[model samples]
Target: MTYTGEVTVGGPPDTREAGDLQITKIAVGPMANNAYLLRCALTGEQVLIDAADEAPRLLELIGDGGLARVVTTHRHGDHWQALSAVVEATGAETVAGEDDADELPVPVDVRVRTGARVRVGSCELEVIEIVGHTPGSIVLAYDDPDGITHLFTGDSLFPGGVGRTWSPDDFIRLVNDVETKIFDRFDDDTWFYPGHGDDSTLGAERASVPDWRARGW
Candidate 1:
């Protein structure tokens, strides 16, 4: 059996209205980490996905209150570095996959398992545990009331590449998971947003997967 986790990234928000969920990408840290600010359209509930490693700079971006949650994609230093500070400053609870949940010093308010959902305002978020990038890497997908689905693939999948797998076992497992689980589940139009680089879609990459596996990357 293969692990099943798929994501579909949708188009960007055209309007930033009071009830429109918008995601702003902030490229920060030495590694050029892409931290995200997910603003809720209805209750104005906002969440941070992988805070800025440069603490001072991140604080400046969402300086004030209103941060509802801090969702860590994984336990990497670059991703979790600002978790504690952000939670303290914004009074937001932290959430992550159960396997890597311990990465946070403090207990995570929500432990995401496969098929778990997180709803904020008018947007609903789905969690998919994607290992191999790390033991506990996961992807996030947000579906608006209008039926647009967007994926937030952490370090699992990339634009022109996939996350490096030092072990052959891990590599094969990860690849199979993405193929049988993710790529097989979604439609061709599903959008893909990786942790690094720009976005792609399941439909676009699904066609090239054979070539991808052929290269043994």
Candidate 2:
């Protein structure tokens, strides 16, 4: 689905705020990848996730520069298509999963591992590595002060199921990791933002976990 262009072309058309954190979503590139802008309301420190495509548009969203960093969730080319452009334009520090760092076009200033945290002002997002999609796929989880949890799941968990896997073994590993690291950890209210398409709640997707595993996709 093509985004309204309200967000992808210029600024955020739909922005969600909770406690001290704010999230804005934009769909860009041929794959309709979802790029996110996460901001700390109190400190105004912001971080961009995915950088997907359309360098000029992504740079515009970053503006003059309150951007603290840019974190690529995985190594897929589409996910980092605009990485170099954004880095050159804003000089923001780049971060990526340690396992996928070498696959990225630009060098990653910080290598992230499971349990590492990325701070956005007063709030923080904890990284949880979920392998299988690309071996370095990760999901960022932030627990809000208001009792809500927000997750930025790269290509790991999607609206309906886990990310596409090449084989049965890959599918099993992805599903198991997601169940152990994610499903067992968070509650129903946790909101997850995927690499493509709309957001979903952990509660909304819990029932399908069994079905997803059985299908082995």
Candidate 3:
């Protein structure tokens, strides 16, 4: 009954309640991409992050509540495999990072930059753009009234290290951005949900920053 943030392609989603919001995470596609469905407890307005794959299953999760918007964290094919399908079915507005918006399968209705806010009823998620993994990969931050921070990091970050980068400069840039913009700004109790695999707290991974930087990955 606990929310572990571990999910398989066909497994039931993991849901967590944070103040006025309900966060549901499910894995889909062969790449095991994680798609998050955020519902506003106050008004029942919903928003989805990454329509990764499995349109039918994602739709089932959406159910009769309908979806207001779909935010794609990056332009990676795996992350938006079902974007067009899901959007067509739900009529949800498409949101993505400004630099990567054009690369998605569907037209991006909202091109967001760092510090931009997306709404779900009365709740708001601030966008943080992290380069390297993709030109405009984003991480959404939700500051709950209950004194918790929840981050949905696309491929820009993971449990043990940051996302994969093609060059040394990119790796450095990614790590620096993550440290300054994310780690430094948020507290240790901040919980992060990655694009793939499990989730971890900043405190749990804080000590490994130097190690991750030294490896140059």
The global C-alpha lDDT for each of the candidates, from Candidate 1 onward, is 0.70, 0.87, 0.95
lDDT by residue for model 3 (138-214), tens: 99999998879999999888999999999998898899989999999999999999999999999999999999999
lDDT tens digits, residues 1-217, model 2? 4422233433344677768988878878688888988888888899999989988877777777458889999999989999999888778899999999999999899999999999988999999999999888889999997879989998999989999889889899999999999999999989889898778889999999999999886
What is candidate 2's local distance difference test score?
0.87
Q: What's the CA RMSD for each of the models?
A: 6.8, 3.0, 0.7
Clashes of each: 4, 0, 0
In model 3, where is the ten-residue run with the lowest total lDDT? 129-138
Task: Name the regions of candidate 2 deviating beyond 4 angstroms.
Answer: 1-12
Lowest lDDT 10-mer window, candidate 2?
A: 2-11
TM-score of each: 0.85, 0.93, 0.99
The superposed Cα distance between candidate 2 and the true structure at residue 58, in angstroms, equals 1.1
Candidate 1 lDDT score at position 209: 77
1 against 2, candidate with superior lDDT:
2
- Off by more than 4 A, model 1: 1-19, 63-65
Between candidates 2 and 3, which one is better according to lDDT? 3
Top-down lDDT ranking: 3, 2, 1
The true-versus-predicted C-alpha distance at residue 23 of model 2, in Å, is 0.5
Write candidate 1's Cα lDDT for 34-121 as tens digits.
Answer: 6777777566677777874766666766656478787888877777777777777778878888888887665799999879987665
